[model samples]
Target: MHEARSASVPVETRAADYLQAASMTAPLLGSGSQETPAVNTYNSACGELTVLLRSSEGGRLWNHPVTLTGNNSTYHLRLEPASHAVWTPNYFTSFELEQQIKEKLIRKENIHKGVGGALVGVRKVNPPEKFAPPRGITAAVTATLDFHGKDATLALRRPAKQPTATVEGKTRPLAANFSAPMSYYQPPGNLMFVGLLGGFNATKYPAPTGLYFMQPYDPDRIPLVFVHGLFSTPFTWVQTINGLQADPEIRKHYQFWIFAYPTGNPILYSALRLREELAKADQLYPNHKPYIVVGHSMGGMLTN
Candidate 1:
């Protein structure tokens, strides 16, 4: 006999409550034909709730952190084959939860036998805390996809396009993937932090000079370069870039970039460095799109 595998996900509060309520209606499945009692575990010691189902022989089945969907009272859960479990809410009475599991098992067997094309790149799992959404999108929508076949092709199904806007006497598709404001600025290193606070000389402590992209660089689009003032890192442009990204027109046409340098550097020297970086980028991409440079505090002089 094959041992059952398990998959665990963090159960969100709303889904957890719905699961607990549904479990009271029916017990979970176990090995053989016996039905196993449903036990809800709440870890008050750590102020956490643990919801899981076990088989009749005391083997574990479905773990919490599963996805639940439906209206207030009706809920349906979908778990991976490892857990080998299925659940139905109190409303799905004609087919009891146990019967539903049996049907699901049959379906799984059919799937494993190559019944239908596999649904690849369909992500229901959430990412780690460091990687959250609405901040920045690094990859194209298709980047989330994975495939076992080289011949596999992805079809992007999108809703109807939104209205368009007129630019330069021509109507164009509006750029509409706008996200809520995120703080992309804010000096990341201790050196930059101390430079802002006090005790800083460019000669003594040279700030690494480089062109940093605040967003993914699109060569086809115009560039909007932001230069921060004395004692401030690229983080000084955080709010400014946020404002620009929030605007639909600006987001559609320009990519945001920031220049970071030790604040103690002389204005002329810093500006020379900025000019060199800009020239380098132009040579690399060779796109003649418009360039918009904005400067803050002493940065205003660099812009000149």
Candidate 2:
């Protein structure tokens, strides 16, 4: 019978090789700089993997989402020098774009596995000129994403010439009049749940106990205040806030507020405290419209 002929099998492809061979095109924004009299432009139009932008003085400028377009493939984009009430530019403006493909391209290769489905192909741009409206020629930039035989133009703009009207009135100052105490933002985890039966010891937890807000107050959106039950902190409503914020219509029509107090307090005392807080808030904000109050567990009796 002798030695049988050895079976020939092809080696399975690796993720790196599959990613490297991904069928996509990279346009003008790439890896090298071309200096000129007026502006310096960098081109990495081919084989571009990643790009990053950092302020010369290390300032973090906010970025805003404009839109996500295309089918079968999608592009995520952010505008440079995101206009903010606080953060200001110290140097040149920058923007970023990423490409994502939904359908699996290679066999046994999972894209964005364990990474929350984030897309790769990140492109960062730092225009040589400042973002302010024109003193010289406009800095033109183009972005394109192609996948599954579909091509999408991500962003194309002359930074100095695009109208600035879009950013106006989009948001308000979050830390000024509508700020909440630091503890409200940090949920106490299991301690919050255990505190219910712990009585007066519940007050010992580090988180503050009082009224709090999830976002800056807006006159246009009616406030929906939530009150938590015995042994519970305002943190209990975090998931509810998340769910509400996910619905664009709900988020647009309402602002979320939370009321936290020591569960050990008498229900009548808690109710009285809530009434006082409401009066104070109404006085400060001075709106003619009635407010919405929701409560859970013992807090529900107080609400009633």
Candidate 3:
């Protein structure tokens, strides 16, 4: 009779050991404060294993085309900071980075096994300073697998200098000034009204007052007026005003004015009213030159 041979350790147990060893050496490989090392299984045409990673520093969040090796699929991962800056408050606070990595792993696992899924187990390694005991600093690795799919995701949020506030049942970051902008207008009141009128006998006027002036004080340049069409307002030219103010070529030649009007009024009445307004401008600012009128849509028809 032959002596019974001692049984070897199971493949799964050996694999777990290899993973633990690799995780232990992860810190030695990178100098950054955040590190993520995760393993996932996929049965696509490519292969059965997939690994994803993101450094504490903002660089490549996902490392694709990763290959696995070893008897039980033990793999080593090493990452370098994308820039010289420390991977701290700049990109992601320590707490945010830790949370991100944990979530990433949990998502990966769910994509591997084809069964009912949820986060099963999670383990944290070395966390950042913000994450202490009560506010523990550590990495969380989670496993999730479901009948539909399996995957993991990681997230990190670090402790702040000033503890945040819980307001209206929601935690909000502390602000230097917690005041809302003051408003001059009150709602639910008709403090403003809209109207339109037309008269064929209205004087054919020129440009209006304050229509022209120099870059520093020129009198020859023509003033341009922009009239917006339906459902529009003076705010439309805000960007144009800013651009013209900055450009030496355009700024030296013209001054821009935008007209806002109610859209519900009849198009013909608005146009006739606009023509009368232009005549008045021409009469008031004779030195400014007859204004160059620009109108959009209905406004264009009126100006013509």
Scored against the true structure, residue 284 in model 2 reaches a CA lDDT of 74
List the candidates ranked by lDDT, beginning with the highest.
2, 1, 3
lDDT (0-100) at residue 50 of candidate 2? 15
Model 2: residues >4 Å from true position, as ranges?
1-184, 192-194, 197-205
Report model 1's TM-score to 2 decimal places. 0.43
Count of backbone collisions within predicted model 1: 3
Which stretch of 10 consecutive residues in model 3 shows the poorest summed lDDT? Answer: 176-185
TM-score of each: 0.43, 0.43, 0.29
RMSD of 1: 18.8
Per-residue CA lDDT of model 1 for 64-129, tens digit only, reads: 223433233333333222110111111111111111122210112211110011111111123512
lDDT of each prediction vs. the true structure? 0.37, 0.38, 0.30
**In candidate 1, which residue ranges exceed 4 Å CA deviation?**
1-192, 197-199, 203-207
- The deviation in Å at residue 48 for candidate 1 is 23
- The lDDT, on a scale of 0 to 1, for candidate 1 is 0.37
